[model samples]
Target: MLDGQSFLISRAVPGSCEQESKWIYMTQHLLESSSNKRPPSQESEEQEQGDRGKRKKSPECPDTPDITDTEHALDLSDRQGSDGDYDDANSFINPLGRDITISCLLRCSRSDYGVIASLNQSFRSLIRSGVLYKLRRQMGITEHWVYFSCNVLEWEAYDPYRGRWIAIPKMPPNECFMCSDKESLAVGTELLVFGKEVTSHIVLRYSMLTNSWSPGIVMNSPRCLFGSASLGEKAIIAGGTDAQGTILSSAELYNSETQTWETLPAMNRARKLCSGVFMDGKFYVIGGMASNTEVLTCGEEYDLNRRSWTVIPNMSAGLNGASGAPPLVAVVNNELYAADYAEKEVRKYDKENNAWITLGKLPERSVSMNGWGLAFRACGERLIVIGGPRGSMGGTIELNSWIPNEGPPEWNIIASKQSGSFVYNCAVMGC
Candidate 1:
């Protein structure tokens, strides 16, 4: 049986501040006491100079992301494209007939993006142009779907808003990327499954726009049991064992837009069964093994712009080798929170104090499970925890969720299942 090291989770895409301004814009309006707009003179418009200079301008909204397409790409064996999903003729006019309104409505049912894209050329144009997603941001509308991957080539999704399990396409094939030791996450509206094909590495992409599964671009190195995370519209892959089971220190960055993988400098130490995360505009590759039972107690942080890695303090406790899963870590309000398996509690790391402080306990059954296939994922504004005993051995599964933004967060049992997979990976696909 795979040990606790095998349980390392492929992390989620860390949220960015790019959309925070938009969310604030809407929330501020909602808090207003009057319906009518304030007089221009009294408004806090940065363009309109105030007594105190430019009224301390708010951050500018980020530019819309782009997806590139190639008409003939057989030269590339593992690439797929949807002609209209991102085309400019996108979205039906909303009730208010405002493009932003239309974008919000479209975002709510992203499962219907492909169906709607086929409805008309106008919708195709809008969807393809990336403007619809841009509008969704402007409106501060977010929709996320939790996707689960079980061992027997089974895949299922849970829609939190609809409160039900949603059907998804079956797992593709064994010849493709394998997730035995895996990483999965959503980038924009697509779920990117990152793993290696035994020894050959590759990424399998499932598009919410196309409602289809297809081969992804490529990976610089095909190593399984590695750590992965999403940051700034790309996936960062760090230390893991290669085909021959060689622990590796090399890393790379995958950009979906250009369908390219740019190799980054190697980390300070070789690691297998490690975890990577995107926090505070940088990528941090955490604990893992460099040799048999030779645990790397500390970690290294990568600066995206500087292309460098800085070692941080060692973790209070490393993932339990016998637990069979990665220690879960989450980012809330730019602070790092991790599951301290050794202590059977959830703790947050204080970089300044260099200490781990307990926040809460693991779910009742979680601690005893040895972390087999356990998952703690960031979904929209909350975290979703899923897993249980290795299903092949037979037992029920659990789903728990929490919105850390709410003070003194509480966990809610989202659901349970009599039959569940020995989870390989889980990610949140969102608009």
Candidate 2:
């Protein structure tokens, strides 16, 4: 297996005093609370240590072939430090104490967690315990990272907040996966990549906690070319075709916390190549092929509380071309938006009228082939478009963004890098 050095790039992002003051207040509150805490008993330490030990390191894959690393990627050995091992596995920053250490670390950017984990065993154990992220969620602190793949076997994560790129480890070698079409979704701290093996469909998952890829738990009914979306620790997968080439209306809900899948009530329609999104506390599946030759214009909304599907007619009418890819759509702040590939324009959904209003043109350089290679997603409050200019000889891929408002769209180029192709799959993980 290739133990290539993970890539890191830093760009200065302007900070505001208001944000800094808020952090100071939160840190002070946590510190004050810690000062009133009593000493932990021996049983508490043992239990906490055992919980950290439960996250077994994934064994290296055997017979894995090596792949070339990207240019400028660093080596893992060069990033190591000389830290003495801690006698107490439960200790986190012995000098500062666990509570104080956690309070300080919470103020740090999520992009720095990987480097923090390398400080010592205690820090590593704390990260893998998943407590910091849980606490972050409770505190309403979230950082959105865009995880995308331009190559079949490799993935890169972009931290828009810090303007950094992290190269993930190469996936385990599988001839079947290398050539097959794949789908990707990021739920909680895990990135799930769905593809097919020789005889069956499989899921390969990459976890931020482990910083590694492993075979994932499969769905109750394994399918591909489906519509899927994630909300916090849960994700829903709807209509698609099974391995036997049968279109299915069957759906399944996955809980990343439990690492299990629950079969969901089937959708009203069976379609393949559809796209999914979460809006207003509901899951929506839009635009796909109902059969080999027929395209679907209607969309379905799945209500979790009622356990039912509602079909919205003309929900995607005129949005998808007859032979085009799945409707390129995303949701930000519970408002829906779609990219009109044929028109090179952006449109927003009017919830009250159940119609789409054309907003403005997309980024001039953001090109796509029937919406196949381009990715439209909501990274927090911004609507981002990821794609490269059209050419047979591929070049740099660009990430552009625009915050929706009453004014016309003014796109800003955030990041770009040389690549042979546009994004094959992409997902946003907010933690």
Candidate 3:
């Protein structure tokens, strides 16, 4: 046998084996149900037992924090002496480097995220940075997900590719969660659930990457039943009711980069409980109940380049007397779609002839709980509709996905769940 001095370098740099062993343990844990953590696999148990009798102490990483924080990457790199140790604390290594690794993770489906997110802190930090999402655009990984909160406050997301449902982290607990039919907006890497605190008006944002909720920058005015839309990194909210429950015409823009809100010129017509949609690089505020008895059909357009708002003509004759919350509208490939609560059908906006085309009716037993029951969300270039047709107060609801590009649309029932089935709000991320 070689002497200690001669075999020093061959002993394997300190705790390399331990690091490899831990990675295997965590990966096994990842494959288990997210609702419960599982023990290491039998292979890992056997490996641990075999090594137990021959175990020998190795040099420990000095000043080595748990590596749970973002700064740990730098710490590990520096400790490894120029060339970092081969033991990457992260899950997988991309031969191309960290950028490629991030892009790969971003390209993964949302259902995969839950498993990956449970793997390690480094993975979480990279995802939360929103850098991967930007890379996704460059790589054209635009698989979208439809997320909605139903009878329960917690949100659930549907993955079109997988044709399944996965639970998202719960919103931060609040005594009184103020949610409107269209209050949820997905901007940048985060989803903002706008509402008023029990005692005051406040907004809460849930970050998908971090898997935690954080207080969002408050709006200039506290409003309920507002029109909201997201344009990737930025979001806008306009024309709702202010504190004390007064109707509002004010509008504001949110910049995720600055984490602040900026006031925009108010709309020409005051609208309460209106719906907003982003189409053709413009924001449109559609029909809303102007008063207890009157519903406003007039709509307005915000031209970001012009920094101006122009009043558009009233909607097609069908929505002339639209009541309650604004119609449930979603934009897919620059075309606008509105869900008709009365007819339970989706209508496509025809710009050329200025008419609404009846696409198809939603699945039977959908609940138009709040006029916005047909929570419509744009998934990539397709559409995901949530809610069943006029079901019993407490019953099951279906999540349907439709691809407009595929000629006439057909509903693919992706999931069914038990609830009072009243969906207060829904949003789509990873677009």
Candidate 4:
């Protein structure tokens, strides 16, 4: 006989097929059940651990707690009651049954907090709305452009972005007969043009709104080349040349609303080519040529409210020609600036310290002829000097340029054309 294991296998091989199949099925069932009950695989376990590590390293979410009604009501109650003491006997009593009503206290508390949050949101909305409203108001009206006129009473407007001057239509023939001069002052939308053409002193009012010229009330005295100042709705004309070549010390005011003229007390000295500036509700007159055969170093102030003249300290040097115009009397850094003809320099008068200081030298000589017809204009923060004859050159001409106090300062030549003989009345256009 064969060994016991070989003899048993041979016997079951063909005859025990059914039992072998049952045994195989039982073994597979046991193996599957055991696998189902077993722990995870090592790779899967390591993957889960990696995921946990990533989650642990990640940042936590920010705190955003939800406030409930009961908490809010408690806060409000605490705020209202300072001492935190409550009397049970004095407490409000509810008529409805507690269980039947389910006590709307929570609802009431929720309503109160809701109202508070709503009010806060509304206040913030109102503030934002108000700021937007103000910004819109400011944006509605912008300083779009500015025009300048030098001679012939002509104005040229410029488009800064386009870098070109726009031509305004000429005044009508009948409307064009009015006198033009370099002594005119433009304040806001009104132009106060004064001239002594014949026997009478006249003022022509040019309205920027209407774009037309109308005859204003005549002055009490016949004058030309006078200095003027605009205060509020009124204009003050002072110190000009009379028809008979007499310097005028008298001053008059023009009211825009009433279209009337009022005469004020005369200045202390007769002045021609004088400069007047309106500052702090008063008129300050600077240097000019006087009738006494002397250039005036004397300065005077005319109070608009008081209607009186008080003399101030003289300028460092006498100023004549168009330098007596308001453009020269620029208030920079709380100080008055004027071109000094006597010193051939720009001078500053400090109102706070009450002193005069020479600032910069002029381009030309200190002679009176060099200074005559020189127009000064305050352009932005710089001073612009327009067309004027330089010295006794007769037919020679000088261009316009700007002078800044600080930074890189230089003269920018505008025009070099000969201004012809006796070019004593030059004006700037579109500046």
Best by TM-score: 2
| Ranking of all predicted structures according to lDDT, beginning with the best and ending with the worst | 2, 3, 1, 4
TM-score, prediction 2: 0.80
lDDT of 2 by residue, 1-431 (tens): 00011121111122322344444455445434433332221111100101111111112111111212211222223222354433444334455555556656665566656655555445555666666766555444567788898887988877776566676788998999988879999988889999999889999999888778999999999999999998878899998888898999999999987899999999989999898999888999998888988889899999999999999988987777657878899887678999999999999999888899999999999877788888898887788899877566667888998878888789999888888457899998877
Give TM-scores for every candidate, taking all chains together and pairing residue i with residue i. 0.71, 0.80, 0.74, 0.52
lDDT agreement of model 1 with the native = 0.58
lDDT of 1 by residue, 43-132 (tens): 111111112211122233333233223112212222113652322222223222224434233323343344334434444434454445
lDDT of 2 at 149: 87
| lDDT values, one for every candidate | 0.58, 0.74, 0.62, 0.45
Q: Which residue pairs of candidate 3 clash?
A: 365-388, 365-389, 366-388, 366-389, 366-390, 367-388
Off by over 4 Å in 4: 1-153, 157-164, 171-182, 321-328, 341-344, 352-354, 362-368, 379-381, 388-431
The regions of model 2 sitting more than 4 angstroms off are 1-91, 94-96, 390-393
In candidate 2, which residue pairs clash? Answer: none
Listed per candidate, the RMSD to the true structure in angstroms reads 12.6, 12.6, 13.9, 34.3
What is candidate 4's lDDT per residue for 296-377, written digit by digit as tens? 7777888766878988765534445433332256542224567765566776666766676776766552234445545554
